[model samples]
Target: MVPTTITLHNTGNPLSPAANERGWLTNPANPRQASFHIVVDEREAIECIPLSENAWHAGDGSGSKSGNRTSIGVEICESGNYAKTLDNAVKLVAGMLKDRGWGVDRLRRHWDWSKKICPRLMYDDGKWTGWIDFKNRVNAELKGADNVKLDSEKVNVIVNGKKIKDGKLENGVTYVPLRAVGDALGATIGFDNKTKTATLDMKV
Candidate 1:
């Protein structure tokens, strides 16, 4: 799918984190059909589906010109740390736009697709002020990418009361090993030889 725009959304549920949203998307027993390419939270961005695939996130019905078909879906988790989550989302989304040679004009809110007031948190008293602020942040991020230098430090990655592996801290974000994460959760890991994609599935 050739994405013309990056569609942004809010998970709506204020308590669910990025990992939980990813897990819900990957779980087979989930009856709801909603899906997204990525989920961003305070800590990191978790990919639920490949970017090349179309996610049924935009409320618009499936069609050639529909947002679900023309845009890549990104849901920002609205948990406790909204400020941090927005920062992480800014990095992730700005990086995506930069990598694709796109500008802030390519960013679209879920409301742009359908009438649903998704990303409701961003609506400032029924005004687009919050959306404008978010876009401004993304624009600043895009401009600052070239001038910023990232520093790294080693840190402990603790999962379920166990230190699985030493992780790295960069730009105020911590990076952990995916294998260790899967192992800690007792998830079955598989690698697709053709696509070179590593998948972690739970034993159900």
Candidate 2:
């Protein structure tokens, strides 16, 4: 299932390095039943699991409609620099929102899914206001971004003086559907599963 929401988490162990956290989650012998999609630190972000599959990060138990089944989990490391860690998290989350075609409204705290106070720094001492601040930052990152824009304005496509299809404008760029382009050009498009390459045969 395509992830519809993003869940934030904190490593909880303030001393555990980001590499060690990644190792623990990925180690075959550790046998810890917990996992997350990505772990972010002040230095870099590490992906432990594929976004296409659900991770056991959310406190929500096994269920059909649980956050674990539908949302992507991101754990922010609390090691080294606190401010840098938050900066990295904000960048990572903004990129995810851009890639997934989601807005800041889709962002959720771990507490929103369960009773856990994960991402402790953002929720501690009744500081839920921090979440709102984070969302605002994400929204700022999204403006004029490279992601697709969901707009109602239709862009008409013309080929050889004939209107073929309609496209959409994203960040001032007009993007036409690939299939539409192929059809307009009178080319046969084929995909190779093994090589994952798209082939256009103009002779056909």
Top TM-score model: 1
Weakest ten-residue segment in model 2 by summed lDDT: 144-153
- Candidate 1, 39-158: lDDT as tens digits: 999998988888988899898999999999999999999997787798789889999999999999999999999978877877745655457657766887899942333477888888
What is the TM-score of each predicted model, taking all chains together? 0.70, 0.67
Alpha-carbon deviation at 65 in model 2, angstroms: 1.3
Compare the candidates by lDDT and give the number of the best one.
Answer: 1
Residue ranges of candidate 2 with Cα displaced over 4 Å: 28-31, 144-204
lDDT of each: 0.83, 0.77
Residue 147 of candidate 1: its Cα lDDT? 38
Mark the regions of model 1 whose C-alpha exceeds 4 Å error after superposition.
Answer: 145-204
Residue 145 displacement in candidate 2 (angstroms): 10
